[model samples]
Target: MKQPLADAPASDAGRLQVPTAVLPLAFGVLGLVVAGAALALWVIPAVPRLTIIGDELVGLSYIVAGTIAWLRRPSNRIGPAITGAGITWFIGDFVFVPNAVITALAYALMWLPNLFAAFILLSYPTGRFFSPAARALFLTAVAVSAAQYAVRLFVLDATGDYGCTCRNPFAVLPNVALYDVVMLVTRIVVVLITLVTLVLIVQRWRHASPAGRRQLAPVLFAGAVGLAAFAADITAYNLTKASADAGALGVASVTGTLLVLARTAVPLGLLFGLVRTRLDRALVAQLIVQLGQAPSPERVDEVLAATLHDQTLRVIYWSPAARAYLDGRGRLVEPSAGEGRAIRLVERDGSPLAAIDHDAVLTDDPELLTSVTAALALAVDRGRLETMVRAQAEDSRSFPTGRVTLLYSDIEGSTALLDRLGPRYADLLAEQRRILRGITREHGGREIDSRADEFFAVFPMGSTPLAAAVAIQRRLRDHEWPEGATVKVRIGLHTGEPEIGDEGYVGMDVHFVARLGSAGHGGQILVSQAARDANAGELDHDDLPADFPPPRLAK
Candidate 1:
């Protein structure tokens, strides 16, 4: 089994497996969040004209569920989530509820503590209790929410519009009523809290570590979304505008969804990431092989990435006594002995994706296990190759290279030919790129970059460059091109310098080679100055451009 490195903590469960309870909880939370969002939009404008109804009840259920889960197991994740959701919903509910109306103080009473708790949940890291900064933020929320709640309570007896967004159901009360005083304080405090949160997280990206920042990034994204929604909500409240309501509601719904993604999805993504560490070499290799055989590369990557992130007992191959590949800031990773176990839990942050820990005897020989891991690595590498190829193709119509020969297999007089053969022939020209890439690896070269009418390859370094080039030549020679078209390619050859890097990128070498190849007559291999040099003054080229210098490569 691939063992997790030290520094990464062992998961409570053996796999990135969520309990059955969590699925229902997830659906329920999402449903309420969405439903409430719809309701909030429907009534936010002309809101005072119509009272908030079951919306409050719907919110209460979320709060109750979260709270109940928390009470049952404070150590579990549900508590913080419940606490945050409860407070967030209250904030939403208050926007529509009339202040100085319907036991106005009752609204404040329920919402105050929830505010403090929400801040803590959002700000604090999961592993430990609260950090100093997080605690400070939490306390600040407590002070602010409490101050607003208190002000509301003290002024509850007197009532009026409060001349604020919270339109009191009892506009019958005078503006100077005691209830109005509370409304004034609440607004000031609410505005301040938002401003402070906004400021603290504005530059969070600068200092936080990747893991810390991952956690922080969502908080910041959520804050921005919240503020935007709040602004829209306030605008709707003030304009007495009907159109504003739907826009406001839509924004709120998006904000909630973003929150879910950050809160749930991010962690879930992390779990998927963890799966890579748990699996044995053979199993992971099998998975990778399956990934290669899969019809859709995107589907394979998504599934593999998910499995790596979420599975528990995620295993990482420790090279030996001390060597670690994933070197991100804040974590120095080196191998450690596992005693009887296959892997030790390692620190998290940019480690290689994990595999699952399998108890099966993966191989009788340790050497065989090593071979399996190498094969797994190669398979994953292939998936990445396909991904990069697709990405490059997306950007442009052509990519130049030097490693593999550049052959602009263009049909002669494509424009005239296109009109003659018609758009149906255009299909064949287009099919050209796809077919080339699919068979690139099979030809002992990878289609490093591609575009319309042309695809470039880098001869696989796994084989001798000469052998690899010869293989490519044969493959190109045999390829049918397009039928019933005058498309014939001029081939280029130069073993000169190519900017070779990840994803088959070749630089200047490819350009000169292609230029040479495209020169001379239409049907032959054109050898460049570099190619002649690589040949050690051996081969004679019949195809050289008129102005080009010819080499003494002919021995």
Candidate 2:
């Protein structure tokens, strides 16, 4: 059976274990249902019609905004906070109930949504309160809100003209003066906290990068408008003091409407910001193309850096054998600590393939990182394979020795060629080595040793060693030499049952082959009688030129 592509999102979805859209959808539907019920039962029946409408609308706004944010960015906490605020605001409508118990419960919980909203604002963009001052302010807001709710539930009378018509079932002592004093203190604290939050938001905005500023602009404007409207409504309500005057009522009604509408702006602004932005599809496409081209580790890093627009991005492979992270050069890599860098681990089938070290800002768009990583999964796995091959090759080089036919070759006049070509000699020397290695490998030869312009290779019995030598000589003769340099090598072959040991063929046969190569002239092949005899039937007379001499004994 054909397997599904491992990198495809559908195939990888099982790894995450949760559908991204499900939770947000569930919460959104629940919030809307609760908001609808609250509007029907509480807002329409309230005495101050405009205030009730404003409050319900603000609650609805939070629901809509929260749902959008949640659906768009399920990993972020902002969505849940806003959504919870909407649900809690709707629950606060229970205060309009005629039952004493319900009214008391509702009154106790009425301020909870505002507390949630304050927290959401303080932790905008990152969803977590990252600063000490921000955390302190959030804790203070929680305490003040809780104190106000407690005072209202236990000390104040609920059956007053203040708001609720139901009696306070939880009230212990009805102290109107004490209630007023507590309420005043709570309001003062709220005002101070609000001011501080605004200041913090401004500071964050000013210090943010251009991209960060674009994300903050909408939320900041909406928050400022909401705060201004809320303050105006509070002032207007205090001034009216339940007056029957038309002008006072009108002012209260207008301010109340504005406040409710402004409250919605907060979520609306966030939703707008999210809607306007999306992951870079072009970068993703480019990355897919680059990865498909069989990229090296360095090339993979370059592509990721270009795609993410972070020049400092690094690709580190996880070496299971070494049990450590390694860079492209096979050197151990220690990721920097507290450098505002993020490590994104890429795994295949629960086993790690590699990790990307990149800027922390990339975490904000986790989907992008995930997409790019998925695209590079195959490349990363290939890197693992290459690393393993290199490790095995190194191990082989450390202990390679076997009883087989060995061939050694050296440039006849390499020193003179280097002096003749000067700086340009290196290029010709490299080309010579490449051609020799390629021909040797093609003839079933395993390279056991290599030095500047010299090669030691082992091959199975037969004409392969002799055939490879002939091919190398012919290539050198037909090729165009550099302007002031020529490439020529002397080849020697011997058949022996030498002991394979660390540092390769170590017995007399190996030394004998080296001596045979040293005795040959440029473009000459000197094979020992044993090698010639082993490949006797396979050797072609026409393959060897008349000018070339036969095998000679190595004393």
Candidate 3:
């Protein structure tokens, strides 16, 4: 049986894993059910309309935004965590119920929504705690929340803390003074944690890469606003408790309302940050259109930098001749990122063709990086050829400048193969070039030029040219061609002093190698006596034919 293609859509396993299209619909129905329950709960208690609207707006905004984000990036945990926080918000409404047990239970967990908000803020965007300090702080916050619930259940008088008449069934010691002290301590601890978190967030922004800053901008701004409002509310509430002043109470009420509004912005900002990469696709679309102009390598670097919004971005072309990455000027360069930068590799047929070094934050969105790498493959390949030409010229300066072995190869009956295979012949020819290029580089040879169905390379006056010729013939003969096609290559090798120019080798030695290659049949490696004599000890009967005709200079 034929194997499936890598990109084929996978079959759904079961109903538990919902399709992307149905996820939003499911979440919508669930939201409606929760909303209906919340409305009924608020109505029976006769809660003020403004209070209910405020609560519902803050809660429902979380649900809607969280659901959209979750659906947009199902792989990220932030979405589901935010949705859970919204549900916790609604559950906290049970405090309004008239039943003592339910009301006490609700009061016991009243701080849970705040805990959720803290967790969301601390882990925004990536949903993972970034550092050991962040993780430690979150654990400390959890302990404080747990402590609040314990104090409410065992020691606190509900009438004093929440102004409720409900009985705390588990309150064995209802000491009002002790409860107030404990509450103040916990409140101070919570305030301290929030302040530290805000500080940490600021540090993250300051240290972030250009791409990281972009991803963190919207979410961090919203979180900072919310945290500030929360701190103001806490301080105002503390002032009202310390002094029996109407102004203090009014300030507390205003800050509380501000806190609610600020919290609503949190989810919206998170949603925007999560989908920012999708928005960046618009730039990539523009990049595709711009690439149609077939811009030069420097022009491509500029276009990509603008497209990705990273001024430090670079595009380095792969040079098969030098077997290394090179800049447009043909100078060898390292492709790995340093410090605040990141690198994305470009490949064709599983071979590394080029690489892009940009802001480290670009890796945060693999889809965007992958799209950019894929979009530039053809353009990078085009640039590689130009780079290779420069690389060969630059490399030749270091050559012996005396005698060198030249190897020329051509595919036998390539025109007939093109006639038979048409467009598919291009793939065959490319595979041929890839094989010969790799073999040449492997034997310490530098590729001089490659044109359709032909390749020319030079090696130091040694056995490498003969070795490369043998490997080339062996590789093509053993390769499995598509549609049972047959490919045979003829190779020619000669050792002589050629007129070296910036354009490449010239004169009689270059012409002799070409004519020498045509004198051989398919799968034959013709070697002039000069190349064999230069490396007389290295050649063996097993590696090359025992007989060779005299040198042929004329075509």
Candidate 4:
């Protein structure tokens, strides 16, 4: 069995219970606090008006969205990555630092948020990269970004460079031509990688399943829009710088604002996808309702199949007595995971009750399965009990006994019927056994032994056994059987003090009961004199034929 994601106790509504919602809650609080601090930076006289406001909004949006995602799915790494990007975006504003060392450090780390955004786009839905190609692209993006920053820091001094007034304290070898060439090449490489990443995202979306598509749609939409806006922002800024014209500057400003607004959709889309991709609570509710009314194993399977939307789903119970898995019919079943199918073990109180075999897609949302199983724990436990009962019946056992009456019965023409019916006879036989067991239990008798089409039961001294025999006769006579097959049973009753051990009644009385049952014709019930005496006044003498013969002892 797979362990739950969180160790917190289960809730009444089956949400992911946590020890406290504090940790992620604190992350959200701190993110907002940092965003507020950045807002203060926006009001500082040294920062550019458009740059400060745009940075603040973009950073705040990512922080808030990241906070929501992290709180919703704390185990996922994507949330923290996004939140880190937002924090770094805010920190990058330290390019306004008066201290030369701090300004240089800030410039080196300023472009990191872009690299983070690239990783986020390449690894949507699942927080991890699924293919080597994706990993390579992510690594390339990081490498190119680092190279660009390094060249800008050492070869191109920021003092009186690129319209920056801050001195480049970390500049070692000033080579303006080399710096521009390296920066241009890195930018071109980064653009190509971004295009490749976009293509990969499209391919993944095309190959995704219906459920997968639902999860990817929002994030993909947001990412594409953000990328487009980013490209436009870069184009406009370059055009404005090259032209030195008022109209170009106006276009750059408009594009920059649009870029900030467009980037907001990326985090919003991720948050939307996370919130939307949840197991339908209604399905779990319906399951709880169905289970409340004593559903059979088949009904349980149907409910689960509908709930999980996997029609091929199967519920196999673990029989502790048999030490194996069994189907609903109590027949042995071997469950293995393969071929786009998987099995999840359902447990209660740390003991295995059953296994749910379902589509492998469900593995993406294991918490849903865990919650559903917790809710269905009672039904699963009941199924375990039913499985044990059915297994015991199929593999009948003997028990210790004292003074009691024994009844042995067999279907008269079972062998011939089986020959005629072939495999269909199994169903008929199962029904017959069911009827017999029901009648036995009704008459206060215990079925101690059963094999093939035969049953051996013990009852207390009373007319109950006689009544059960007659009831079985009438039921078999009137019941509608398959293929117009007639069902007839021969029962033998004997009263004696039999010494029953682990293997059941062991004395001559048991053999005597078998012999008496074998001698009787179809639909006949033969009783020993001892049974007749024991039931004396309770036995309806009128029901017995007047010409019935006296009991004979077995040699």
What C-alpha lDDT, on a 0 to 100 scale, does residue 210 get in candidate 4?
Answer: 58
Model 4 over residues 423-474: C-alpha lDDT tens digits? 8787667656655765776678777767888888888765388888877776
lDDT of 1 by residue, 1-555 (tens): 355323325574434235534644554566466446536645545453222343344345445555444443445454455445544544434444444453354444545434533453444334233346655765776776776566555534343322134533433433344544555455555656556555555655455434344434433454455544444443433334232212235544444334323333322322232232234334656665665662232344444334332212223322211133211111223433343223323222344432323222221123333444444455544544554467456345333443334332333355665676565554445434433444454445445545555555544333233333333343334343333344444456566445545544456765665565555343344655644444443322233223434421322
* lDDT by residue (tens digit), candidate 2, 251-351: 77688667667778888787776655454645688788777655545777898887776777888766553346667544567655345667777779878
TM-score of 4: 0.61
Residue 177's C-alpha lDDT in candidate 3?
Answer: 84
Where is model 4 more than 4 Å wrong at Cα? 1-30, 46-51, 71-74, 96-104, 159-164, 231-255, 277-283, 293-314, 319-323, 326-333, 339-341, 359-361, 383-555
The worst-scoring run of ten residues by lDDT in candidate 3 lies at 1-10
Decreasing lDDT order of the candidates = 3, 2, 4, 1
lDDT of 1 at 546: 37
Evaluation by TM-score, superior candidate among 2 and 3: 3
Residues forming the 10-long window of minimal summed lDDT in candidate 2: 240-249
lDDT of 1: 0.43
Query: What's the count of clashing pairs in each model shown?
Result: 47, 1, 0, 0
Instruction: Provide the clash count, candidate 4.
Output: 0
- After superposition, candidate 3 runs with Cα above 4 Å error: 1-32, 160-164, 242-249, 274-276, 381-555
Cα lDDT of candidate 2 equals 0.71
421 Cα displacement, candidate 4 (Å): 24
Per-residue lDDT tens digits for candidate 3, residues 1-555, read 111123323554354357854765576557657766767775554344565566688778778877877776676667776776676666656666666777777778766777777777777676788778888999999998888788887886565333246668778899888888887888788888889989999998998867678788877888889888888877876777631111224778788778878888888787776566678887888887776555655778998887777878888766554456766544567776687777777788767788888887666566677778878986666544543463456455654468899999888898988898878787667656766766776677877887788888889865377777887776666555655677887788999999877677889999988888977778888889998887565544374344544534563
Q: State the lDDT at 424 in candidate 1.
A: 56
How far is each candidate from the true structure, as Cα RMSD in Å?
A: 19.9, 15.9, 13.0, 13.3
Of models 1 and 4, which has the larger TM-score? Answer: 4
Winning candidate number (lDDT): 3
